[model samples]
Target chain A: MDPTDRETACFEAGVKFGALYHQFAGTPVSAKNADSLETAIEESIENQPGCSAVSVDIHTDKLETTRGYTELTGEYMDVTLRIEYADCIVHAEMEMEDGYPLMRVVDIVEE
Target chain B: MDPTDRETACFEAGVKFGALYHQFAGTPVSAKNADSLETAIEESIENQPGCSAVSVDIHTDKLETTRGYTELTGEYMDVTLRIEYADCIVHAEMEMEDGYPLMRVVDIVEE
Candidate 1:
């Protein structure tokens, strides 16, 4: 069967989530620059097609700053994305679920 | 509607590709560090579930070395991944398609 608009929307959402998490995972981040990193991540992913909005929160307190900077990972941040494809709008999120980063679709609205 | 095993395999393949592209897209790279980054990327993505193997090649000749290091991008790398889910096996690739990075499913085999 051909993929529906809703399915494509979900796939696009998954793409964004995977991209957001992996692309910045090993970045060198620290407490002092967490703010800038968060903003940069949001702006960067927003450049993708179908992505209407992106929000990133990096937990500075959880950052491993022992070396002044540590590699960023899913454990230190949470992300939400709003993706619109055709008439289907999808909401997706990446959060730590059971001590692991999980990307999931939260909702879908058709317009 | 529920997604089939093949659809889920495709979705998982997309996740790995997106994660691979985004996670390392903006890292500082040069001729010397390209090898290490490529290795790191392959090992990192292979750690994910369903990813059987990953191969990455960094085109060091394209490295913009005026600053001694340039941010990595899809333009600088070509990646191929093998993903195994349930009884389905997926082969996927990310390469330059008309000056833009294109992620695609190359083939699928079931056993």
Candidate 2:
């Protein structure tokens, strides 16, 4: 349900990529909420320069709320953005303890 | 040559985590260069708030130079920091196209 042509093209253009995390709770999520969450993430990343991929997925349609993170990969930058949602509240954390330009998604895929 | 106990403890404390990319270039990289790169990354990530992991690896020591991305994951944000290096010059790109809090390394590990 993620990964699109526009996003793939961006990667070819050196735009890089990223995707939202999803958890499965054995139930379905509200279509309205899911759409809203997806829209918010898409617009946010798209607004950033050099951002190539912005995707979201539900862990479990029944989990009601999901917890996860976002992946971002640029030509020289790579990191993950953590996210937790509950009661309609979303919190974000930036985890880059490893160092600058750590593991590239390219390597992760190719390796 | 990655994932240490202190870093592991930080994750246990909710510090979040990240890792550098390595491409194995066929030959081994200089110990001096490797140490410097590793130290720089370790210190930098350890300095950040909510940062819990800092690790580095060589893709291919014989490649002369390597290209990759850094991964960061916080409680609510997930993203990648792209990096390109050649002739000792490192270029970084931030790829957050999809949105906020994309993929959690946890899911990538467990899934």
Candidate 3:
């Protein structure tokens, strides 16, 4: 059977999320590098096929430490993102370890 | 800086999972259709860059129904997969709705 329009949109969103997750998870995070990290994420997601607006919320333990210590230890980041697509909203959450996103989800939902 | 061997391996695994999830989730499921689903998943993952072995387990609500009823109401499936790559093992879990994977993860680990 052929995929419905919704299914195709969701699948494409998943593909975009996969690529975005790789870009974000591969970066080491520290207090000094946080802005650049967010920027990179925003740019990648916004560039996706249907994404019109993208918001990212990132929380990491490494930001609490002194810059020197954070630079040495790196950070574990949890990223929550809401992306507005033309047809639906995609909500994504990711867990990062040693600067790599280990697990994640990108889902199209009503809310 | 270049990605380490582990990071590159993990990233490629993520890419494979993304593609596999799209393929699997787009198909409607029933008891009669489960084997084909598993076959598609295994073939896709095993063809990834470093994958050597692929296993898939699928559980669904629509399988308990009589075949006729199952054909009318598609199944909601949950897929758990383990893919063995040359460098690491990748475990993935997916939740499907109306025959599309809405959420998922592909993670590489020591186990």
Superposing all C-alpha atoms, what RMSD in Å does each candidate have to the true structure? Answer: 4.2, 18.8, 16.5
Clashing residue pair totals per candidate (backbone < 3 A): 3, 78, 0
Write model 3 residue lDDT over B11-85, tens digit each, in one string: 344455555554444355666766777777688667655656566665644455554324312135554555454
TM-score for each of the candidates: 0.70, 0.24, 0.40
Error of 1 at A78 (Å): 2.3
Off by over 4 Å in 3: A63-75, A81-86, A95-111, B1-111
Candidate number of the best DockQ: 1
Please list the residue runs of candidate 2 whose C-alpha ends up more than 4 Å from where it truly belongs after superposition. Answer: A1-111, B1-32, B60-62, B65-104, B107-111
lDDT of each: 0.83, 0.29, 0.51
Per-residue lDDT tens digits of candidate 1, residues B21-88?
87788899999889999999999999989999999999999889999999999998899998898998
Q: Interface RMSD (C-alpha) of each candidate?
A: 3.7, 15.9, 12.4
Error of 3 at B43 (Å): 11
lDDT of 2 by residue, B24-72 (tens): 1122344345556545655664454334344444332333333432222
